[model samples]
Target: MPTDLVLLNSRLLDPGTGGLLPQTALAAADGRIAALGDDRGIGALAGPGTTVVDLKGAVVVPGFTDGHLHPVSGAERTMGVDLSACKDLASVRAALDAARRSLRPGAWLRGWGLDPNAFGEQPVGFAAVGAVLDGVPAAIDLFDAHSMLASPRALELAGIDGPRRFAQASEIVCDADGRPTGLLLEDAACALVEAVAPVPTEGELLDRTAEVLRTMAAAGLTGGHAMDGMRLGFYAELEERGELALRFRIAPWCQPGADADAVAELVRLQGTGGALWQVAGVKLFMDGTIDNGTAWLERPDCHGESTHAFWPDPQRYTEVVGELHRAGVATATHAIGDAAVRHALDAVEKARTEGGREVRHRIEHIETVPDDTVARFARLGVTASMQPTHCCEFTRADHTDNWSRRLGEERASRAFRCRDLWEAGARVVIGSDWPIAPFPPLTVMAGARHRRPSDLSLPPHGPEQALTPLQALQAYTVNPAWTACEERQAGRLAVGFRADLTVLADNPLNVRDTELRDVPVRLTAVAGRVTHRAPDVS
Candidate 1:
């Protein structure tokens, strides 16, 4: 007989039934919802020693679940240099100078989220960044995280000596003289830099994980799917320490070579049944990103480029995806372009034919899905896991000539159509892709509803494919839960469901569009225990 707590006088929004009930009371006991109904009905179920919280005029809804986010990368970035605010070369140099002076000598100086285009210039070379750092080793990531600007000292440390050739499916944008430009495009350069960089200790990783969980809880998020590159035994360690607070569905990046062996190891490590800290899933990258002009396309956009750099061998991708499916491990692959999407769909179809159905795999991004592939997702029972903010972020670019010319007007309309996918019968799940965009569910909801940032006007980009506020909310809540296969125990507010809910300062349905980003999360509860609460402003 665990003590019960009754949340009274709150407006409840249930996405499961598309219903809004006012002055509702929700009772929680033994880490599960005991009763939920009108105030009188719920009050009658409350025991004598139960606690009662009057929410007054606030709104209550199921806790948000970010379907995709890089929690580990995000945590590390929080302690590293944040170039997200640097607007120009001068600002970048100034920040580098400041970081170099503050950091230990020869320690890797890393920064993320610098857009060369935003700095009002074409991509610059390493010398540009080197001149600013006065020869300090540094690596500044572009906004897409697909590319980076590395100083000469940093490249030297990575043992990248003279005229480095970009690996297959990777590009090393170079000067006419064949000298390595500061920019490292695609996974080749990224892998080199990562191999040389310092790996955080187990303790440090756990500390960072805790910090990220607190931040997510503050943002009204109680759970997320961590899609960070595989760091062996990372989740196991966190779970052992009991430091992982938020519900995490970790999908480790698949390693090259021995696909079956690697997946077997992952499965054995996962043990029987899933837990809050770890679940069974392997992440694969089928192609490059659109921001860097690497997304794979069937017909070379007007740019004459058919696909972003492929991983040298398409067989490796097929092997990895196929083996995981055969082993009964769920797979989530990143496919942003039409060609990559088709390729991924083909792999899933093959897996189903050979390995039998029941492999509930998913396609990440689907930013530029083609019309023909929409129905294929539903027929194959593949989940379309997408991020809403990318649509607004990319569409708002003023200079769209390059992208528009490459993607043609007709084909561009198919970009990130959440509503269209839903109509096509795809199980559409929304995610923030966090370190790439804000993780606040309210912000994501607004972006989907408006199809543009608050300050930007709706580009005729895909307005007809935009989702309503309620529909967008469902994508963030129930759809993600369904994709994760946790719908019965999570996502909704019915009896026997997890007591995970967020209390907002105002009803989201009544809040202004602009106010969505600023919506204050008054309280957050996980497993029937309040984890976060905003101080009373009055």
Candidate 2:
């Protein structure tokens, strides 16, 4: 049988060499790479009706996978006012006001990706945004999704009128008089306000999901490990309707209170759906974000100490992780602080003791960790799931951002040790942490390699933590596939592997670090299907 699709005149990046493959053309048949040969050599295998694409000297590599991102939530967040670009509270209000003109009367005024540091010394509460919101009901998610600011009406809508303590580390900030200040921290607190927030219809959900995935495809992503599972059905519905462009592994969230019974239920539902979208793991929050005061740190910072874990009962959390491991399910913990990192590693070790080390568990957003804990990742065979763009987006090298201000220079210097993790023999995976940062893997890779904001004058935050180009490529490809347990089927250009390839306008390995981000994606193919093709691609 002749090849169904042919990609010609392109360079291929090989994992083994950490460089381009010798061949310049690839043949695909039955949704798998059938053969690889030099340019013009594989043309003989093309059928009369074969769809041949001329890459025109572009670089082709395995389609990038997002190791950690919340597509459902990210999409919903994009729909609201994108306050991520706003540099200050005044700028944020201006963007909100601009968006307000197009909204319906009495409609919920929502915003997302609001940078806490952008407010300078101002507290994240109604005092900073009440006048702008007027009488509108609004829930604005912080850039890290760790906290949010709401208006008075929005607070009323969520039925919160005073300070409250949650089982988790979430806090509904209040004044000395116990009056609600419209600042909600962590998921537990966010849930209180979001519980009564507007719910999108099934149709709206599908549309938004489609929009986000298409954008991801254009940005060269073929898969993602969706961190949240509340909308697994949205991805399922997409595949069912043939609109699902990116494959996903759903990790349903597992908060503190879940017991053995909940773990058992997740185990039962693990492989219910195969391939496109599978529930293979559970997400746990070991600690909260550093920008806020909830993160469980190793010791006291300038603002004093916050050494508590996000999970009220750390022992129970460890026990449940063991249960999940015994059931052959994976667990990904959102551990940002050093204490949280150590505690999560301890939990992984406990699970490994009982279930063995074959399961690929992970710790996400490892923003800050002790130097010693770096050895544990490789020792326990735990994957370090990180977002490079977080450093680029949130912190400055001078310890000026909210996160840096909280940790101080001592701990902040060791933040996001991607290079150290890889050097320590740990499998590291990178992602956009979308809606929190840019979703494009190109931008994410550049951030991983440079760790600087676009301004070259500004010193890069934790420059030593930056990853080499080849290592960053591994994180975006095979490393993530290994974590997803799909290394055998995807993440490579082997004949038996899925025909998932992303073609870039330039060789990523050879390009300048800054130029890499602007390298356009020429084509994106998933299993022999062209999900996206640049206008110039023929």
Candidate 3:
């Protein structure tokens, strides 16, 4: 059959060699690569209906895949106040006041990206929040999504009269007199406020997702491993309707109290995931993020004080993990502290011993770890799903930020061990942690490659842990596909693989580290169809 599309006059960069292939054109037929050769050789395969894209000598590489992110939640968060830029209470109030102007009557005020650490010495309390929101009901999530601040009206609406007991580690921070202080830590506590917040409807979810995925496509993301599971069908519906352009692999939350029977049920349910969509695994929170002092740490340091695991029963967690793996389902766990990382590894080891499955299990957000644990990832065949922007946007180089202050100097210096994990032989994959941090892979690559200090005034944090450009590129491209067991279907540009490619204005492999983010994406194609093209791309 004649080729459906011919991408010519481009540099086909080989990720493995960090060099361009001698063949400079690619032919796609039936949504797969048909041929790779010189412009004339591949171009000759193009028939009358074929779309021939003139690349103007741009660099073409495999489309990027985000290792971890919440697609549904990220889209919904954008509907409310984006407090990501707010640095103080007054600014937060100003942002809320501005956001409220666009909201409907009687609707609750909602906001995201609130970082209490910016307050420096100021208190974050209901009184402080109520002063800004006034009588309006409001719920503001912390940047890490591990905690939240609720206005007095919002608390009343959520019926959080006082601190309540939880099955797992959670905190409804209160004052000396037992007055609610507006801070809710961990999912259980955060749920108190969320229980009252309005959930997006099915239509809203699909619409919001379509809007966000387009943004993602233009940024060169050809696919994502979405951490949100219940929304899998939503994306599938979009794919069915041709609205979902990017490929997705969904992992729904695997909660406690489920037994081996539940794993069996999950395996049966997994069949629902199709080509553009898949329910490949379950997502479990082993520990909260370090930002709110909720992370599970072995020994408490002044910087991050909590030593509690999110799971009520560690034995149950291990059993469930083993059960799931035994059934051949992948698992992705959220582990930030060294203790949590160690615990996760132990569980995987236990799973392997019993089930003996070779499924890819990942440890998400490895913010800190013991030196010995670095080699354990590779030895145990674990993937390190890390976010470089977490280090640059949140942690401080001088060990004074919220996270660094919690761990103290000794442990803080070892945070986000990206290079160490890779050098130790672990499959290191990178993601944005979106809404928590920016989602652009190129911008993320800048952080991975440079470890630039959040504040240029300060020194770079853990520059020794920074990744090389090639290593960073692979993290966004090849590593993620491998993590999801889609290496043969996607990740690389080759015959027999899906014709998903990202064209860059400049070759990142040949550019200076600082210039990576600035290099624009000229075009993005998925399955031989052009999803996004720069206005001047022609």
Candidate 3: misplaced stretches above 4 Å? 101-105, 453-458
Compared with the true structure, the alpha-carbon lDDT of candidate 2 equals 0.85
Per-candidate TM-score against the hidden true structure: 0.90, 0.97, 0.96
Candidate 1, clashing residue pairs? Answer: 126-182, 169-309
RMSD to the true structure for each prediction, in A, is 3.0, 1.6, 1.7
- Residue-wise C-alpha lDDT for candidate 1, range 36-121, written one tens digit per residue: 88888887777787766778767888888888888877776656687766656778778878888888877878888775545444
Identify the runs in model 2 with alpha carbons over 4 angstroms from their true place: 39-41, 455-457
Ranking by lDDT: 2, 3, 1
lDDT per residue as tens, model 3, 163-206: 88898789898888887988999888989889888988889878
Question: Candidate 2 residues 1-538, lDDT tens each?
Answer: 6677899988888864677788999998887899999867788889897889988899889888999999987787777788888888789889888887877988987788888887789877778864778888888888887888888888888889887778887788898999988888888888887888887777987898898899999999988988988877787788888788987888888888886677777788787664467887989988887877888888866677467899999898899888888878889998989998999999889888877656888999899887799989999989999998888878888888888888988888888999999999999999988878888998898899999875454678888888988888889998998888888988888887888889999878888887788899999987777889999889
Q: TM-score order of candidates, best first?
A: 2, 3, 1
Residue 245 in model 3: lDDT: 73
